[model samples]
Target: MTTGSQRTRTVLHLPCLGPDAVPLERAVAAVLGYARGRRWLRFRSPGRPEGRWVRVPAFGWARFDAHPPSTGPDADVLIAEGLHGRLDRTGWHAVHDALVGLAPVVEAVGARAAGRPFWELPADEFSVLDEPGTVGALLRHLGQEAGPHPAHVLAALHHRHPDLVPHLTPTTRRALLPHVEEGDSGVEAVVHRELRANAGAFAELEAAVAAVVGDARPGRLRLHDVLLWLTTTLRLAHAVELGEHVAG
Candidate 1:
Protein backbone atom coordinates (compact mmCIF):
# COMPACT_ATOMS: atom_id res chain seq x y z
CA MET A 1 0.00 0.00 0.00
CA THR A 2 1.26 3.48 -0.82
CA THR A 3 1.63 5.80 2.13
CA GLY A 4 0.52 9.44 2.07
CA SER A 5 4.07 10.74 2.05
CA GLN A 6 4.99 8.44 -0.80
CA ARG A 7 2.07 9.65 -2.90
CA THR A 8 2.95 13.27 -2.18
CA ARG A 9 6.50 12.66 -3.29
CA THR A 10 5.32 10.92 -6.42
CA VAL A 11 3.22 13.93 -7.36
CA LEU A 12 6.00 16.38 -6.62
CA HIS A 13 8.59 14.47 -8.60
CA LEU A 14 6.50 13.36 -11.58
CA PRO A 15 8.42 13.49 -14.87
CA CYS A 16 7.84 16.01 -17.62
CA LEU A 17 7.45 15.57 -21.36
CA GLY A 18 10.52 17.09 -23.01
CA PRO A 19 10.21 19.85 -25.60
CA ASP A 20 10.94 17.45 -28.47
CA ALA A 21 7.88 15.38 -27.57
CA VAL A 22 5.79 17.68 -29.79
CA PRO A 23 7.48 19.30 -32.74
CA LEU A 24 6.47 22.95 -33.01
CA GLU A 25 6.09 23.85 -36.69
CA ARG A 26 4.92 20.40 -37.68
CA ALA A 27 2.19 20.36 -35.05
CA VAL A 28 0.90 23.79 -36.05
CA ALA A 29 0.82 22.81 -39.70
CA ALA A 30 -0.98 19.56 -38.95
CA VAL A 31 -3.70 21.21 -36.88
CA LEU A 32 -4.34 23.97 -39.40
CA GLY A 33 -4.40 21.44 -42.20
CA TYR A 34 -6.77 19.09 -40.42
CA ALA A 35 -9.18 21.95 -39.82
CA ARG A 36 -9.83 22.24 -43.55
CA GLY A 37 -11.51 18.84 -43.66
CA ARG A 38 -15.29 18.87 -43.29
CA ARG A 39 -16.73 17.95 -39.91
CA TRP A 40 -18.19 14.43 -39.55
CA LEU A 41 -21.96 14.09 -39.15
CA ARG A 42 -23.25 10.76 -37.94
CA PHE A 43 -26.35 9.18 -39.50
CA ARG A 44 -28.68 7.27 -37.20
CA SER A 45 -30.31 5.44 -40.12
CA PRO A 46 -28.69 2.21 -41.32
CA GLY A 47 -26.82 3.01 -44.56
CA ARG A 48 -26.61 6.49 -46.23
CA PRO A 49 -22.77 6.76 -46.24
CA GLU A 50 -23.14 6.20 -42.47
CA GLY A 51 -23.33 10.02 -42.12
CA ARG A 52 -23.20 13.19 -44.16
CA TRP A 53 -20.15 15.41 -44.30
CA VAL A 54 -20.84 19.07 -43.68
CA ARG A 55 -18.62 22.06 -44.31
CA VAL A 56 -17.57 23.90 -41.15
CA PRO A 57 -17.39 27.64 -41.85
CA ALA A 58 -14.99 28.03 -38.98
CA PHE A 59 -12.65 25.14 -38.37
CA GLY A 60 -10.04 24.33 -35.73
CA TRP A 61 -10.35 26.08 -32.36
CA ALA A 62 -12.77 28.56 -33.82
CA ARG A 63 -15.32 25.78 -34.22
CA PHE A 64 -15.27 25.40 -30.45
CA ASP A 65 -16.38 29.01 -30.07
CA ALA A 66 -18.81 29.07 -33.01
CA HIS A 67 -21.10 26.50 -31.42
CA PRO A 68 -23.85 28.01 -29.28
CA PRO A 69 -24.22 27.61 -25.58
CA SER A 70 -20.50 28.38 -25.83
CA THR A 71 -18.55 26.40 -23.22
CA GLY A 72 -17.02 29.32 -21.42
CA PRO A 73 -17.01 32.77 -19.82
CA ASP A 74 -18.14 31.02 -16.61
CA ALA A 75 -16.63 27.89 -15.08
CA ASP A 76 -19.90 26.66 -13.63
CA VAL A 77 -21.62 26.84 -17.00
CA LEU A 78 -18.78 24.91 -18.52
CA ILE A 79 -18.95 22.24 -15.82
CA ALA A 80 -22.71 21.87 -16.03
CA GLU A 81 -22.51 21.30 -19.78
CA GLY A 82 -22.01 17.68 -20.70
CA LEU A 83 -20.59 15.96 -23.79
CA HIS A 84 -23.98 15.66 -25.42
CA GLY A 85 -22.41 14.35 -28.60
CA ARG A 86 -20.98 11.37 -26.77
CA LEU A 87 -23.24 10.77 -23.77
CA ASP A 88 -26.97 10.03 -23.55
CA ARG A 89 -29.27 12.13 -21.35
CA THR A 90 -28.68 9.87 -18.34
CA GLY A 91 -24.89 9.94 -18.76
CA TRP A 92 -24.98 13.67 -19.30
CA HIS A 93 -26.95 14.25 -16.09
CA ALA A 94 -24.62 12.07 -14.08
CA VAL A 95 -21.60 13.99 -15.35
CA HIS A 96 -23.29 17.35 -15.01
CA ASP A 97 -24.52 16.73 -11.45
CA ALA A 98 -21.30 15.11 -10.37
CA LEU A 99 -19.24 18.04 -11.61
CA VAL A 100 -21.67 20.68 -10.38
CA GLY A 101 -21.76 19.10 -6.93
CA LEU A 102 -17.99 19.41 -6.67
CA ALA A 103 -18.02 23.12 -7.40
CA PRO A 104 -17.62 24.08 -3.75
CA VAL A 105 -14.56 21.92 -3.28
CA VAL A 106 -13.06 23.10 -6.56
CA GLU A 107 -13.78 26.71 -5.69
CA ALA A 108 -12.24 26.25 -2.25
CA VAL A 109 -9.09 24.84 -3.76
CA GLY A 110 -8.97 27.52 -6.44
CA ALA A 111 -9.31 30.13 -3.72
CA ARG A 112 -6.11 28.98 -2.07
CA ALA A 113 -4.14 29.44 -5.29
CA ALA A 114 -5.36 33.02 -5.68
CA GLY A 115 -6.12 32.47 -9.39
CA ARG A 116 -2.52 31.67 -10.27
CA PRO A 117 -2.03 29.25 -13.15
CA PHE A 118 -1.11 25.74 -12.10
CA TRP A 119 2.11 25.93 -14.10
CA GLU A 120 3.23 28.89 -11.98
CA LEU A 121 2.38 27.29 -8.64
CA PRO A 122 5.15 25.99 -6.43
CA ALA A 123 5.48 22.38 -5.30
CA ASP A 124 4.20 23.16 -1.81
CA GLU A 125 0.75 24.15 -3.10
CA PHE A 126 0.38 20.70 -4.59
CA SER A 127 0.38 19.36 -1.02
CA VAL A 128 -3.37 19.82 -1.13
CA LEU A 129 -3.33 16.62 -3.13
CA ASP A 130 -2.31 14.72 -0.06
CA GLU A 131 -4.73 16.43 2.30
CA PRO A 132 -7.10 13.97 3.97
CA GLY A 133 -10.43 15.16 2.55
CA THR A 134 -9.52 17.38 -0.34
CA VAL A 135 -8.29 16.16 -3.70
CA GLY A 136 -8.45 12.47 -2.75
CA ALA A 137 -12.04 12.78 -1.68
CA LEU A 138 -12.92 14.78 -4.78
CA LEU A 139 -11.50 12.04 -6.95
CA ARG A 140 -13.40 9.36 -5.06
CA HIS A 141 -16.61 11.33 -5.35
CA LEU A 142 -16.08 11.89 -9.05
CA GLY A 143 -15.44 8.19 -9.56
CA GLN A 144 -18.65 7.29 -7.76
CA GLU A 145 -20.79 9.87 -9.51
CA ALA A 146 -19.26 9.86 -12.99
CA GLY A 147 -18.36 6.20 -13.15
CA PRO A 148 -14.88 4.81 -13.98
CA HIS A 149 -13.62 6.90 -16.92
CA PRO A 150 -11.91 10.07 -15.68
CA ALA A 151 -11.93 12.05 -18.95
CA HIS A 152 -15.23 13.83 -18.23
CA VAL A 153 -14.22 14.88 -14.71
CA LEU A 154 -10.84 16.15 -15.84
CA ALA A 155 -12.40 17.88 -18.84
CA ALA A 156 -14.92 19.64 -16.56
CA LEU A 157 -12.15 20.77 -14.24
CA HIS A 158 -10.15 22.02 -17.21
CA HIS A 159 -13.08 24.09 -18.40
CA ARG A 160 -13.47 25.56 -14.93
CA HIS A 161 -9.80 26.61 -14.67
CA PRO A 162 -8.00 25.97 -17.91
CA ASP A 163 -4.74 27.24 -16.54
CA LEU A 164 -4.92 25.10 -13.43
CA VAL A 165 -6.34 21.88 -14.82
CA PRO A 166 -5.22 20.20 -18.03
CA HIS A 167 -8.01 18.61 -20.08
CA LEU A 168 -7.61 14.88 -20.56
CA THR A 169 -8.93 12.36 -23.09
CA PRO A 170 -8.08 8.69 -22.72
CA THR A 171 -6.19 8.55 -26.01
CA THR A 172 -4.22 11.70 -25.28
CA ARG A 173 -3.45 10.61 -21.74
CA ARG A 174 -2.23 7.22 -22.83
CA ALA A 175 -0.23 8.60 -25.74
CA LEU A 176 1.33 11.32 -23.59
CA LEU A 177 1.70 9.61 -20.23
CA PRO A 178 1.14 5.90 -20.58
CA HIS A 179 2.69 5.11 -17.23
CA VAL A 180 0.41 7.32 -15.18
CA GLU A 181 -2.49 5.31 -13.83
CA GLU A 182 -6.02 6.59 -14.43
CA GLY A 183 -8.31 7.00 -11.37
CA ASP A 184 -5.28 7.24 -9.09
CA SER A 185 -5.56 9.94 -6.44
CA GLY A 186 -2.16 11.15 -7.55
CA VAL A 187 -3.34 11.57 -11.16
CA GLU A 188 -3.80 15.34 -11.02
CA ALA A 189 -0.43 15.73 -9.44
CA VAL A 190 1.10 13.74 -12.24
CA VAL A 191 -0.71 15.90 -14.80
CA HIS A 192 0.47 19.04 -13.04
CA ARG A 193 4.05 17.84 -13.13
CA GLU A 194 3.77 16.90 -16.79
CA LEU A 195 2.33 20.26 -17.78
CA ARG A 196 4.93 22.14 -15.75
CA ALA A 197 7.66 20.02 -17.24
CA ASN A 198 6.55 20.76 -20.77
CA ALA A 199 5.47 24.33 -20.14
CA GLY A 200 7.83 25.68 -22.76
CA ALA A 201 6.49 23.35 -25.45
CA PHE A 202 2.90 24.19 -24.62
CA ALA A 203 3.68 27.89 -24.60
CA GLU A 204 5.33 27.56 -27.95
CA LEU A 205 2.29 25.69 -29.20
CA GLU A 206 0.03 28.45 -27.90
CA ALA A 207 2.02 31.07 -29.79
CA ALA A 208 1.92 29.08 -32.98
CA VAL A 209 -1.83 28.53 -32.69
CA ALA A 210 -2.36 32.21 -31.97
CA ALA A 211 -0.42 33.19 -35.05
CA VAL A 212 -2.55 30.90 -37.18
CA VAL A 213 -5.95 31.76 -35.70
CA GLY A 214 -5.35 35.50 -35.11
CA ASP A 215 -7.89 37.16 -32.70
CA ALA A 216 -9.89 33.98 -32.23
CA ARG A 217 -7.06 32.10 -30.50
CA PRO A 218 -8.12 29.75 -27.76
CA GLY A 219 -6.43 29.46 -24.38
CA ARG A 220 -3.08 27.67 -24.15
CA LEU A 221 -4.64 24.87 -22.12
CA ARG A 222 -7.34 24.38 -24.73
CA LEU A 223 -4.81 24.46 -27.51
CA HIS A 224 -2.77 21.90 -25.65
CA ASP A 225 -5.87 19.74 -25.28
CA VAL A 226 -6.70 19.99 -28.97
CA LEU A 227 -3.14 19.36 -30.06
CA LEU A 228 -2.87 16.22 -27.99
CA TRP A 229 -6.31 15.03 -28.96
CA LEU A 230 -5.72 15.45 -32.69
CA THR A 231 -2.12 14.31 -32.98
CA THR A 232 -2.67 11.19 -30.93
CA THR A 233 -5.96 10.14 -32.46
CA LEU A 234 -5.67 11.33 -36.07
CA ARG A 235 -2.01 10.50 -36.63
CA LEU A 236 0.42 12.99 -38.14
CA ALA A 237 0.26 11.34 -41.57
CA HIS A 238 -3.47 11.93 -41.92
CA ALA A 239 -3.08 15.48 -40.71
CA VAL A 240 -0.42 16.08 -43.34
CA GLU A 241 -2.62 14.62 -46.04
CA LEU A 242 -5.47 16.87 -44.95
CA GLY A 243 -3.11 19.81 -44.91
CA GLU A 244 -1.93 19.01 -48.43
CA HIS A 245 -5.49 18.69 -49.64
CA VAL A 246 -6.37 22.01 -48.09
CA ALA A 247 -3.37 23.73 -49.62
CA GLY A 248 -4.25 22.32 -53.04
Candidate 2:
Protein backbone atom coordinates (compact mmCIF):
# COMPACT_ATOMS: atom_id res chain seq x y z
CA MET A 1 0.00 0.00 0.00
CA THR A 2 1.41 3.35 -1.03
CA THR A 3 1.67 5.50 2.03
CA GLY A 4 -0.42 8.62 2.15
CA SER A 5 -1.24 10.69 5.23
CA GLN A 6 -1.73 7.94 7.79
CA ARG A 7 -3.53 10.36 10.08
CA THR A 8 -5.98 11.33 7.39
CA ARG A 9 -7.33 8.16 5.79
CA THR A 10 -9.74 7.91 2.92
CA VAL A 11 -12.37 5.18 2.54
CA LEU A 12 -13.03 3.21 -0.66
CA HIS A 13 -15.41 0.40 -1.54
CA LEU A 14 -14.24 -3.16 -2.00
CA PRO A 15 -14.51 -4.04 -5.69
CA CYS A 16 -14.67 -7.82 -5.60
CA LEU A 17 -18.05 -8.79 -6.99
CA GLY A 18 -17.68 -12.05 -4.97
CA PRO A 19 -19.19 -15.44 -5.90
CA ASP A 20 -22.95 -14.99 -6.34
CA ALA A 21 -22.40 -11.78 -4.35
CA VAL A 22 -22.21 -12.41 -0.62
CA PRO A 23 -24.80 -10.92 1.72
CA LEU A 24 -23.47 -8.47 4.34
CA GLU A 25 -24.58 -10.84 7.12
CA ARG A 26 -22.09 -13.45 5.93
CA ALA A 27 -19.40 -10.85 5.63
CA VAL A 28 -19.99 -9.57 9.17
CA ALA A 29 -20.02 -13.16 10.38
CA ALA A 30 -16.51 -13.50 8.99
CA VAL A 31 -15.44 -10.53 11.09
CA LEU A 32 -16.80 -12.19 14.22
CA GLY A 33 -14.98 -15.41 13.42
CA TYR A 34 -11.71 -13.52 13.22
CA ALA A 35 -12.14 -12.25 16.74
CA ARG A 36 -10.69 -15.66 17.68
CA GLY A 37 -13.50 -16.05 20.17
CA ARG A 38 -11.68 -13.58 22.36
CA ARG A 39 -14.53 -11.11 22.56
CA TRP A 40 -18.25 -11.09 22.04
CA LEU A 41 -19.27 -9.39 18.82
CA ARG A 42 -22.83 -8.30 19.02
CA PHE A 43 -24.76 -6.54 16.29
CA ARG A 44 -27.44 -4.49 18.06
CA SER A 45 -30.18 -3.53 15.64
CA PRO A 46 -32.92 -1.94 17.70
CA GLY A 47 -36.15 -1.01 15.97
CA ARG A 48 -35.90 2.68 16.87
CA PRO A 49 -34.02 5.86 15.97
CA GLU A 50 -30.93 4.55 17.78
CA GLY A 51 -30.47 1.78 15.16
CA ARG A 52 -27.73 -0.86 15.64
CA TRP A 53 -24.47 -0.65 17.54
CA VAL A 54 -22.09 -3.57 16.99
CA ARG A 55 -19.78 -4.34 19.87
CA VAL A 56 -16.89 -6.81 19.85
CA PRO A 57 -15.89 -7.66 23.40
CA ALA A 58 -13.29 -5.08 24.39
CA PHE A 59 -14.20 -3.19 21.27
CA GLY A 60 -17.04 -0.84 22.17
CA TRP A 61 -18.75 0.84 19.23
CA ALA A 62 -21.03 3.83 19.59
CA ARG A 63 -24.18 3.86 17.46
CA PHE A 64 -23.69 7.02 15.41
CA ASP A 65 -22.57 7.26 11.77
CA ALA A 66 -20.36 10.23 10.99
CA HIS A 67 -18.66 11.60 7.91
CA PRO A 68 -15.44 10.03 6.55
CA PRO A 69 -12.08 10.55 8.33
CA SER A 70 -13.73 10.90 11.69
CA THR A 71 -11.50 12.97 13.96
CA GLY A 72 -12.41 11.09 17.13
CA PRO A 73 -12.29 7.52 18.34
CA ASP A 74 -16.07 7.65 18.23
CA ALA A 75 -15.62 6.66 14.59
CA ASP A 76 -12.49 4.80 13.78
CA VAL A 77 -11.95 2.88 10.56
CA LEU A 78 -15.51 2.55 9.28
CA ILE A 79 -16.58 0.06 6.68
CA ALA A 80 -19.56 1.17 4.63
CA GLU A 81 -20.83 -1.75 2.68
CA GLY A 82 -23.51 -2.04 0.04
CA LEU A 83 -25.59 0.77 -1.33
CA HIS A 84 -28.91 0.62 -3.09
CA GLY A 85 -30.53 3.20 -5.40
CA ARG A 86 -29.46 6.11 -3.18
CA LEU A 87 -26.13 6.77 -1.38
CA ASP A 88 -27.71 8.45 1.67
CA ARG A 89 -24.72 10.54 2.70
CA THR A 90 -26.69 11.95 5.62
CA GLY A 91 -27.39 8.62 7.27
CA TRP A 92 -23.85 7.41 6.64
CA HIS A 93 -22.54 10.56 8.22
CA ALA A 94 -24.70 9.76 11.22
CA VAL A 95 -23.26 6.26 11.25
CA HIS A 96 -19.73 7.57 11.09
CA ASP A 97 -20.38 9.84 14.01
CA ALA A 98 -21.68 6.88 16.00
CA LEU A 99 -18.88 4.45 15.12
CA VAL A 100 -16.29 3.87 17.85
CA GLY A 101 -13.68 1.15 17.45
CA LEU A 102 -9.96 0.53 17.01
CA ALA A 103 -9.62 2.61 13.90
CA PRO A 104 -9.50 6.40 13.55
CA VAL A 105 -11.94 7.16 10.76
CA VAL A 106 -15.35 5.51 10.62
CA GLU A 107 -16.49 4.83 7.07
CA ALA A 108 -17.80 1.83 5.13
CA VAL A 109 -16.82 0.14 1.88
CA GLY A 110 -18.48 -2.66 -0.11
CA ALA A 111 -19.59 -3.75 -3.53
CA ARG A 112 -23.06 -4.74 -2.43
CA ALA A 113 -25.03 -3.43 -5.37
CA ALA A 114 -28.36 -4.04 -7.06
CA GLY A 115 -29.16 -3.83 -10.80
CA ARG A 116 -26.00 -1.71 -11.31
CA PRO A 117 -22.84 -0.74 -9.42
CA PHE A 118 -23.24 1.87 -6.63
CA TRP A 119 -20.15 3.96 -7.43
CA GLU A 120 -20.87 7.58 -8.11
CA LEU A 121 -21.98 8.63 -4.63
CA PRO A 122 -19.18 7.63 -2.26
CA ALA A 123 -17.50 9.23 0.76
CA ASP A 124 -15.49 12.38 0.14
CA GLU A 125 -12.87 10.52 -1.91
CA PHE A 126 -12.53 6.86 -2.94
CA SER A 127 -10.73 4.24 -5.01
CA VAL A 128 -11.70 0.67 -5.81
CA LEU A 129 -9.54 -1.96 -4.05
CA ASP A 130 -9.35 -3.94 -7.29
CA GLU A 131 -5.88 -5.45 -7.26
CA PRO A 132 -5.53 -7.98 -4.41
CA GLY A 133 -9.21 -8.24 -3.42
CA THR A 134 -10.49 -5.82 -0.77
CA VAL A 135 -11.46 -8.43 1.82
CA GLY A 136 -8.09 -10.16 1.82
CA ALA A 137 -6.30 -6.86 2.10
CA LEU A 138 -8.55 -5.80 4.93
CA LEU A 139 -7.64 -8.98 6.78
CA ARG A 140 -4.01 -8.20 6.31
CA HIS A 141 -4.50 -4.66 7.50
CA LEU A 142 -6.40 -5.81 10.58
CA GLY A 143 -3.62 -8.40 11.25
CA GLN A 144 -3.33 -11.84 9.64
CA GLU A 145 -3.11 -13.60 13.03
CA ALA A 146 -6.77 -13.10 13.94
CA GLY A 147 -8.13 -15.05 10.94
CA PRO A 148 -11.39 -14.26 9.10
CA HIS A 149 -14.21 -12.28 10.64
CA PRO A 150 -17.70 -13.81 10.91
CA ALA A 151 -18.80 -11.14 8.54
CA HIS A 152 -16.32 -12.47 6.01
CA VAL A 153 -17.62 -16.03 6.38
CA LEU A 154 -21.20 -14.88 6.08
CA ALA A 155 -20.35 -12.87 2.99
CA ALA A 156 -18.64 -15.83 1.35
CA LEU A 157 -21.61 -18.03 2.13
CA HIS A 158 -23.96 -15.38 0.81
CA HIS A 159 -21.88 -15.22 -2.38
CA ARG A 160 -22.32 -18.97 -2.92
CA HIS A 161 -26.04 -18.55 -2.54
CA PRO A 162 -27.53 -17.52 -5.86
CA ASP A 163 -30.23 -15.49 -4.15
CA LEU A 164 -27.76 -12.77 -3.09
CA VAL A 165 -26.20 -11.56 -6.30
CA PRO A 166 -27.80 -8.28 -7.22
CA HIS A 167 -28.39 -7.69 -10.94
CA LEU A 168 -26.50 -4.98 -12.83
CA THR A 169 -27.61 -2.26 -15.25
CA PRO A 170 -26.24 0.84 -16.94
CA THR A 171 -27.59 3.12 -14.24
CA THR A 172 -25.97 1.15 -11.40
CA ARG A 173 -22.74 1.02 -13.33
CA ARG A 174 -22.83 4.76 -13.85
CA ALA A 175 -23.72 5.37 -10.22
CA LEU A 176 -20.70 3.37 -8.97
CA LEU A 177 -17.99 4.49 -11.38
CA PRO A 178 -17.39 7.95 -9.94
CA HIS A 179 -16.30 6.37 -6.69
CA VAL A 180 -13.53 4.11 -8.03
CA GLU A 181 -11.50 6.40 -10.22
CA GLU A 182 -8.71 8.63 -8.91
CA GLY A 183 -10.18 11.67 -10.59
CA ASP A 184 -13.44 12.64 -12.21
CA SER A 185 -13.56 12.08 -15.97
CA GLY A 186 -15.59 13.99 -18.50
CA VAL A 187 -18.63 11.80 -18.01
CA GLU A 188 -18.56 12.25 -14.23
CA ALA A 189 -18.30 15.98 -14.64
CA VAL A 190 -21.42 16.04 -16.77
CA VAL A 191 -23.34 13.94 -14.28
CA HIS A 192 -22.29 16.24 -11.43
CA ARG A 193 -23.51 19.21 -13.42
CA GLU A 194 -26.89 17.61 -14.02
CA LEU A 195 -27.20 16.54 -10.37
CA ARG A 196 -26.46 20.11 -9.28
CA ALA A 197 -29.23 21.36 -11.54
CA ASN A 198 -31.60 18.82 -10.03
CA ALA A 199 -30.56 19.90 -6.53
CA GLY A 200 -31.84 23.39 -7.22
CA ALA A 201 -35.20 22.05 -8.33
CA PHE A 202 -35.42 19.89 -5.21
CA ALA A 203 -34.54 22.84 -3.01
CA GLU A 204 -37.35 24.87 -4.54
CA LEU A 205 -39.85 22.09 -3.96
CA GLU A 206 -38.75 21.81 -0.33
CA ALA A 207 -39.21 25.53 0.19
CA ALA A 208 -42.68 25.38 -1.31
CA VAL A 209 -43.65 22.56 1.03
CA ALA A 210 -42.30 24.38 4.08
CA ALA A 211 -44.34 27.42 3.16
CA VAL A 212 -47.50 25.37 2.84
CA VAL A 213 -46.96 23.73 6.26
CA GLY A 214 -46.49 27.18 7.83
CA ASP A 215 -46.12 25.94 11.40
CA ALA A 216 -49.38 23.95 11.13
CA ARG A 217 -47.59 20.59 10.96
CA PRO A 218 -44.58 21.80 12.98
CA GLY A 219 -42.50 18.68 13.80
CA ARG A 220 -44.06 16.76 10.93
CA LEU A 221 -42.65 19.14 8.36
CA ARG A 222 -39.33 19.24 10.21
CA LEU A 223 -39.19 15.48 10.32
CA HIS A 224 -39.96 15.33 6.62
CA ASP A 225 -37.21 17.85 6.04
CA VAL A 226 -34.76 15.71 7.96
CA LEU A 227 -35.78 12.67 5.94
CA LEU A 228 -35.41 14.68 2.79
CA TRP A 229 -31.86 15.67 3.71
CA LEU A 230 -31.07 12.09 4.55
CA THR A 231 -32.54 11.07 1.25
CA THR A 232 -30.44 13.68 -0.48
CA THR A 233 -27.28 12.40 1.22
CA LEU A 234 -28.21 8.88 0.19
CA ARG A 235 -28.58 10.10 -3.35
CA LEU A 236 -25.11 11.67 -2.99
CA ALA A 237 -23.53 8.29 -2.07
CA HIS A 238 -22.49 8.68 1.60
CA ALA A 239 -24.09 5.61 3.10
CA VAL A 240 -26.68 3.05 2.24
CA GLU A 241 -29.76 3.22 4.52
CA LEU A 242 -31.05 -0.35 4.19
CA GLY A 243 -33.07 -0.28 7.40
CA GLU A 244 -36.13 1.57 6.12
CA HIS A 245 -37.40 -1.64 4.53
CA VAL A 246 -35.17 -4.24 6.23
CA ALA A 247 -35.42 -4.19 10.02
CA GLY A 248 -32.05 -5.73 10.74
lDDT tens readout by residue for model 2, 72-105: 3222213223212122566444333333231221
lDDT of candidate 2? 0.27
Across 103-177, the per-residue lDDT of candidate 1 in tens digits comes to 676776567567787667665444454555544344434444454435666666665566655666667656645
* Candidate 1: residue 10 Cα off by (Å): 29
Instruction: State the displacement of the C-alpha of residue 211, model 1, in Å, after optimal TM-score superposition.
Output: 2.2
Q: Each candidate: how many clashes?
A: 0, 59
After superposing candidate 1 on the true structure, give the runs of residues whose Cα lies further than 4 Å from its correct spot.
1-20, 34-36, 39-53, 56-86, 126-145, 148-150, 175-177, 181-185, 240-248
> Please, what is the whole-model Cα lDDT of each candidate in the order they appear?
0.53, 0.27
Q: Model 1: which residue pairs collide?
A: none
